[model samples]
Target: MKTIDCLGDMCPIPILKAQKALKLSPSGTTIKVVTDHSCTLESMLNHFKKYEITSTEVINGVWEIFITKS
Candidate 1:
């Protein structure tokens, strides 16, 4: 699992990074993204619906979004 810290990033930055990660990662690879923004999390959740992904709340306003490339 590769982790991308998007704690301070906003909007398209987080989603953009996730896209790059997915494009670079091999099949079945899971990339873990840490975000502190609700909008960022929501964007990722909806954007990642096309693939295998999961989300876990680590704490208040903090989440770990895992995306496994299909």
Candidate 2:
């Protein structure tokens, strides 16, 4: 499990970082992204959905996304 803390990041920073991390991660790895921005969360979710990755977002502002290499 890899944890990504984007708590204070704004806009595309969190989403960009998460995408980079996912590219470097192996299959079946889990990445926990902590962000305070709802827009970033939504963008992240959308990206994940596009890739068919499994993700869960908590209204409290935490997004736990799971990715598996195909």
Candidate 3:
């Protein structure tokens, strides 16, 4: 899985990074996104809601989103 770290990034950055990664990745690929911002997480989920989101959970207090290209 490819990982995009958006720890200190705010709105749009995380989404942009995810977009870039998705564009480069093939269909059915799974990517892991790490973000510390709550708004980012919500925005990401909302923005890419059409894609397959495998999981959204907090690990060690940080939010992690797993999305699969479809």
**TM-scores for every predicted model:** 0.93, 0.70, 0.88
Instruction: List model 3 lDDT by residue over 1-70, tens digit each.
Output: 9999999998899999999999999999989999888887788779998898754657655788888999
Model 3 residue 28 distance off true place after TM-score fit, in angstroms: 0.6
Return the top candidate by lDDT: 1
Worst 10 residues of 2 by lDDT: 61-70
**Cα deviation of 65, candidate 2, in Å:** 5.0
Clashes of each: 0, 0, 0
Regions more than 4 Å wrong, model 2: 51-70
Q: What's the lDDT for residue 19 in model 3?
A: 93
| Tens digits of lDDT, candidate 1, 1-70 | 9999999899999999999999999998999999999898789878889887788889988999999998
Off by over 4 Å in 1: none
